[model samples]
Target: MKFLLPIFAALLLSLTTVNARAAEHGTAEEAIALINKTAAYLIDEGPERTFFEVSNPRGRFTYRDLYVVIYDLQGRIMAHGMTPRLVGLNAMEYRDDDDKQFVREMIERAAKGQTGPVDYKWVHPQTQRLHAKSAYFRQVGLYVITAGIYK
Candidate 1:
C-alpha cells in the first residue's frame, strides 16, 4: 500500500509537469507578434545582426515553442531559431505530412507582400511528434520573417 501511494504521487507529479510545459507553448497571437517583432528587428538591425540573433536558440526571438525562421525571396533559409543547421538550406520543396509545399507557399505569399497564417503539419520541437502548426509571416523587403505555434 505504501509503495502504491508513492507511485501515485510520482504519476501526479509527472502529469503536473507535462501540463505546465504544455501551458508554456506559445499562442497564435504570440506567434504573430513574434513575426512582427522579427520584421521590425530586421528593418532596424539589418540581416547580418537580425539573422545572428534569430539563429540563437536562446535568443529573444525564441520563446516557449515559438521560434523565428527567416527565408529569402528565393526560398533559401537565411536563419532558423530551432534548427541552426537548416540555416543555409533551401526549403522551397519541403513538404508536410499532407504533402503541402509549405515553404514554397510561404515564399509566394511573402513575395506578394502578404501577412497571415499558413497552416501545416510540423514536428513539434518539444514533443518531437507530428502536430498541426500555424505559422505567421510577414515580408520585410526581400526576406520573410516567420514564427509559428503548435496546435
Candidate 2:
C-alpha cells in the first residue's frame, strides 16, 4: 500500500507536469526559433521526408497548437503540420472573415523578405473555434517556414 501510493502520486505529478507544459507550449519566441530550426532540418533532411514529418499531427513538428507550416515562394502549401488537405493548395487566396488576406501577407513577410510576426485569425486545431493568432516565420532558400501561437 505504501509503494502503491508513492507510485500513483508520482504518476499523477508527471501527468500534471506534462499537461501544464503542453498548455503553455507555443509562444512567439518559440515559434520563431522552431521555424528557423525546422527550416534547417528540412534543408538537411530533404523535402520528401521532412514534409511527411511536418504533415504528421503527432510528429515532432506538431506541438499542441503550434505546428510548422511551409509554403513555397509562389504561395503553394508545401507542408502543413496539422492540415494535410492544405498541401499543394495555393493558399494565397485564403482570407479571414474580415477579408484579411493572411496567407498572402505571410508570404510577403516571410518569402525572401524578412523574419517577422504576421497576425491573423485561424481555426484552433483542438478547440475547433476561431482565435486570433500571430505567427513568426522565416524564409529559407526554397520555402518559408512558419510557426504560430494563438492568443
Candidate 3:
C-alpha cells in the first residue's frame, strides 16, 4: 500500500507540472481573439497603420507566446508582431522542419475565404526549437491575419 501511494503521488506531480507548462503558453482561444482583434484594427485603421502596429514587438498584438502575422494573398508578409524583420518578405517558399510549406497552405486557405486553424510545425520564439503549432487565421480584405499557439 505504501508503494502504491508513492506511485500515485508521483503521477499527480507529473500531471501538475504538465498543466503548469501548458498554462504558461498561449491557447487556441487567445489566438482566435487576437486574430479577430487584428482584423478589426486593420479594417478600421487601414493597412499602413495597422501593419506598423502589428509589427511592433511590444505591441498589443503580441502576448504570451502568441503574436499576429499578416500576409497578402500571394504569401508576402505584411507585418509580423514577433519578428518585424519578416515584414515585406515573401514566405510562400518557406517550409517547416518537416518540409511542409505552411505559408503557402495558409495563402491557399485564405484565398478560399476560409477562416480556421492550420496545424504545422514551427520554431517557437521562446524555446528556439521546432514545436507543433496551430495558427488561427481569417481573411480580411486583401490580407490574412493570423495568430498561433504552440501545442
Clashes of each: 0, 0, 0
The top-ranked prediction according to TM-score is 1
Per-residue lDDT tens digits for candidate 1, residues 27-65, read: 988998899888889899999999999999999899898
Instruction: Give the better candidate number (1 or 3) by lDDT.
Output: 1
Compared with the true structure, model 3 gives a TM-score of 0.85
Name the regions of candidate 3 deviating beyond 4 angstroms: 1-21
Predictions ranked by TM-score, top down? Answer: 1, 3, 2
Show model 2 residue runs off by greater than 4 Å: 1-22
TM-score of every candidate relative to the true structure: 0.95, 0.81, 0.85
Query: In model 1, which runs have C-alpha deviations exceeding 4 angstroms?
Result: none
Tens digits of per-residue lDDT for model 2 on 37-114? 788788899988888888887888876678988898888999998888889999888898779988788888765587
lDDT of 1: 0.91
**Residue lDDT tens for model 3, 1-151:** 8889989999999999878877879988888899999988999999999999999989999988889999998899999999999899999899887888888888788888887677899988977888999888889989989898898
Q: Could you tell me which 10 consecutive residues in candidate 1 have the lowest summed lDDT?
A: 109-118
TM-score for model 1? 0.95
Q: Against the hidden true structure, what lDDT does model 2 obtain?
A: 0.83
RMSD after Cα superposition, model 3: 4.0
